[model samples]
Target: MSDEGRLIAGRYRLIERIGRGGMGTVWRAEDEALGREIALKRLHAQQHLSEDELATVHERTRREARSAARIAHPNVVVVHDVLDDEGLPCIVMEYVHGTTLGALLKGGGALPPGEAARVGLGMVAALRAAHAAGVLHRDVKPGNVLLGGNGRVVLTDFGIAMATGTSTLTKTGEIIGSIDYIAPERMRGHKPGPTADLWALGATLFQSVEGRPPFRRATAMETAYAIAVDPLAPMKQAGPLEPLIEMLLAKDPDERPSAEETERALRVVASEAPGATMGTATGGTTEVAWASAVPSRATATVAATGPTTSAGATLTDSGSGSVPPTPISGGGSGSAGDGTGRPRRKRRRLLWSAAAVTLAAAAVAGGLYAVTADDGGHGRKGSGTATAPTASEPSPVPAGFRLVREKTLGVTFPVPDGWKRDGRASAEQVTYTDPSGLVGLTIGTVNPAGANPESHFQNIEANTKLNYSTYRKLRMQRTTFQGKPAAVWEFTFQGQVRAFRAIDFGFGEEGGTEYDIYLSAPEAQWDTHRPVFDTVKAGFRVG
Candidate 1:
């Protein structure tokens, strides 16, 4: 955003950039009519947005404005207005100034255990208030909880939030929330309610006490593994913040602490952080991250776990304190992720092999995905050490890109990284491997032997079925991958579904290699990484 002023909805004047994400950009602006500073949200669209997504954002904004307006609690951030800037939608919200909790921890990265509890309690108080008014803040995390100069905390940004006692805005398959904070049920592509909010809060509080979120991973694949398999434990590293941290960060939504319970527990814990006064360990190094240092709220620097994490890194802790995490300038820019899926198994085949390993010869195993229900209210401490990847080792690139490219029609594009590629010596078959190298993609070239396009499309139809833990669907569409026009489809296999997706190569100027790309994953991952399919399709290249 430029410093030069621009009017929004013909009423507000932009003052400065507050923050930005893959979804939209936020600005600190003044409402000329009211003569007050407001945080203005604007969406930037590089490509045309789908009508459904646009409506979802607009309706979500409208719903949030109404919901935020309804709950006029001191603990909740205020929404002043909703604006439609040109064809896109935005919100004008109260701009609070303070440091974020994340910044405070990262400067040196440790906080007095008691202070962390106080922060958690404040969040509970806010949640209780919102939930009571029929709102569930599904997207809770360290950043959403903001600190006020008045020594108070306010919850803000209800983007992916769902109002309680109401139908969800998106469908069952549309996964929302930060992946690390997303509930297991959500990971399984289920629509969540208040429990989802609790799961996210548990993750957020874990950060306050552990110095990092509970789920640890070397790459997107590993993190998904941990989030799906690891238990929420804040031992040794944040052993000081034991008991309470354990309670809030519980894996199972039902097993986790309730808002009321969390508030009561934290109140008990706050009586115990170093402070001149109870509920007020106020003084600290004020030099924090952007928006956080000076105080009208906060900001920080952290790397996105996936392409999405780039937008996710550094939460505005909102507490008045020192900042932590690296700044944006210190790292690369872009969203952190693409697609989400569980591992699928396949028969061993040479990296660039050319054989039709019979489909029934090998298969992906199915199992009940584990997501914690608050079995015990107190979050237990896990023993493993969770740390960032060492800077010395660079991530390894996928083993191959032999997935077969059709340059015959003068059309080709790069494949996504982390996937192993292979095309048969026959050129009619290509395979792309998953992160685990267990299951792989199978591609059938155009006019293979006696096979024709219609028959091939039928085969594509049969191959694209997607199955989840509880539901199944066969969805297909005509789109492009790497710029080349093609068809995309899927058959959802429930029970932590995993699959092999393929797209047939279209014909070129003369007789050319018709290409196809098929990919699959576990059910738990569908929602988290579904966007990648569209991304690959949008990037599809063909003449």
Candidate 2:
């Protein structure tokens, strides 16, 4: 039956086609029962598939709906329902009424770093939620991210998600997802993981700011080969994002930072980047990162006029740069100013040396720490506003130390006079270190909300043991801190250049907030640094 103006499952009324791909067509439809619009997707060539292939495709569509439905984060699209229409499977999804990120790039060219960072944070949140639910979104690209009219950046199209420990659905040795964005490990036939999704996120961010994916080529085979064997070209337009992009695109999944770490870096970028390059009608900044590189004004003019598309050579992948966009309005203001959009404050450039340096660099580059309100178990409302400590009732400093009060974390502590603050501070964590970088002190919080304290440590220890090199646990026991339930953990591990010992204490606050203090040093010299940990714990106070 013709889909246009037809009702499916006795409720959905197809209005018009919104998108097309090799395997399916997406239509804007209205849900008669719910009285709301939706996106209805159905296969394009169902008649061509053999019986077995058809079954597999059907299973895949059902899985896509399940996979997307499993995640409940704000940044993920909602799956409404799935049903059969004329013997073909159709997926009902929330209709996002804005342009795809791919389309935005096509129409506006490279986006400003601040805008890209904002978009990236939403994607990371979606991925984090999916990974936590044991789902791996196998396909993550610019086209799958929706920039919604409600100002929500959502990740869509999880048609190829690999649910954890589930049996493989793809034929043996057949790769899936966009070739240009595929991780090196995936190309080598390794099972996909959370890091693989991160690699695709890196490619998406790169394309958002550079107007092209990093591994583009004339053919799919060449692009795959380049992804598998070649080094990433240096990013000239990425600026501070360069280090994060480089780390995410690491050839080895083991080398990529965890989702927690990546989110922190992106938050730093979002909080610090100046503003966005808005539409021409608003008279905002036109100085995109790659604007000077394009030689012809006519080509630039063509790029600016409408969506410019490129088709993927592989049938399974929806190619990069292909999108149909909707217009965007509402220019930037205030801190997100409308002028040249250059950074107004000086930021710490990414040192890009060792893991320690990477952490330190993020701190330097970040302007505001992500703040959270902890009401000592009384339900403190969350706020993003920074709260600098009052000049009158300053945190007290010890004789040989300086008092540091962080308005974001709403905490205060003392550090040795010679010690410098090196690590970044988010609402979640903060750090300080000696000039040598070997000895450090970190204060952090984990929102247990209501989970048991011991289980939290157990889970963290499990992940640490898996990821940390030559990790050894000395002690991890439930204890008491300042008359409160707490846990203590001690361990030793190999760093990139040396062996290190560390001690940690996590105490539960009245409102189910958990605060932790960690200290690390050279394994052989741990005793010399142990006293500093005691001193920090003694002086630490959270309001």
Candidate 3:
């Protein structure tokens, strides 16, 4: 039997070798401490290095372990313990049961749009969190993405990710991560920053959807050429994804859409996702962090185009580049500008849907025809202008189809593809259900401006029409969402547990502030669908 198969560090009994990478060996092990499974990554202790050299290597490993432990993100692999056995270091991490994106791609080709969007969104969200904590994931390629049990997507192997604000343990100007995914500027010996990771994400997203990277070369020089000199080839099978692929693969790091933009854009396709968040029962990561709060040109579009898109609007970051707070044009001007991903002043005060109505209002309220009374200006009695009152039309619904609507206490949304939306309009609530009766898509909207999410939850419990008493008993609790402060509520209803997960923001919905909340189904399906709320939750943006 090989030494690799032997157990190490006493309690972690190695069952078998699952994988081998350049830096470590991963073994399926029993964590007797918790009596659950874990991935034990041990440095090649048997390698031919001197005792002092071994000590130095393990010292670096320990530093990485400490760095990784502080991440505390769902997308990044969770590191449970670092053990020293026989003077060598071993890291115990959460064991992921699903295949890596690399393995998935090796067996086949590009992923479909929804799956691709899901993966891309997960990766971007992970990078955003990491960057906020001042860490740069130098090695952010597909091989490092781990699909965990419970369909959780995690970015792994933070061994090379380093803190950005200071020159810590890592060597100065020492390039790390994969060579193939390195940004062109970094390849030329420039200091790597958040932008570098964005470039890598573009490369990774391209490969995930097109079956090949944006650049491929037999030699390092040719690889650099592909990234530096040549224009990226249009991804063959990527359709509407053309926009995302273009943004992710943009040559200028600054031009790439922020991680938030990528995630928001993905929601259009992911909204109809039938299963788990990604629905594949696993996850992966491979993107970089955006620079700051302002919207970048890559993600922001001028409103010369129509206001409504099947995809949702981008939310600006709250940091350095945030858009200035000011009102623009008649309520929402004809266009919205983006700064560091925030909604420009013009896009404020209305979710994109209201913009449609506003446009029509603009057309109807023009000039003397405004003189018409409450009956509408169309052929007003004795008014000088009877010119077939110009009407601004909303986009056409498909033939033989009528749009349905749904809502909860304070929130409402349109059902696009016949999930049979049914709910109240003016009362500020909505609900949706497909034929199968699995999902209880209930929503509550509130313009709780002066109140925080906590007080607002209390308000929701008191006013909701169904199970108000039981819901009040659940009581809202605060918890971490990805990296944001979030509120959650768990309750029992009719022999099943129901959980609501939400993050609060002052949204411009229907000319008011809204809580923009989401609730998972009863317990029978909670485990199956709760993750979907996160996907939908990310789509909620405030201008």
lDDT for each of the candidates? 0.46, 0.60, 0.47
Minimum summed lDDT over a 10-residue window in model 1 is located at 324-333
On a 0 to 1 TM-score scale, where does candidate 3 land against the true structure? 0.49
Pitting candidate 1 against candidate 3, the one with the higher TM-score is 1
lDDT by residue for model 3 (457-482), tens: 33333322121222223344543322
lDDT of 1 by residue, 1-543 (tens): 454499887889999886777877878889999898888877776366678877776787777777888788888888888868777778888988776665565643655667776677777777888888888777887667777777788788787667766668865445566666776445434446576677677677677766777775444332433443233432665543454454344333333445665565556556544552564222232111111211110001111111111011111111221111100110011111111232221111110021232223222111112000001101222211122122233322223322234442233433556665432111122334455543333322332111222223333222112212322334444433223334433443211123322112232111333344333333344443333332332233444
Per-candidate TM equals 0.52, 0.53, 0.49
Best by lDDT: 2
Error of 3 at 374 (Å): 78
Candidate 2 per-residue lDDT, tens place, 1-543, comes to 376999999999999998998778999999999999999998766777899998888888888999999999889999999988877889999999998998888753897777887899899999999999999998899999999887799999988898877777886556778877887666545577798999999899999888898877544544553454334666778865766777677554544566876776666666556653322212212122212211110100000001000000001112222111000000011122112343312111112223233232232211111111111111212211133223244455657788887675567878878876632233444556665656656555544322434544454444334323356777767765555676666666543344566666666654465666666666777767776666566666777
Which residue runs does candidate 2 get wrong by more than 4 Å? 275-543
- Per TM-score, what order, best first? 2, 1, 3
Q: Rank the candidates by lDDT, best first.
A: 2, 3, 1
In TM-score terms, candidate 2 sits at: 0.53
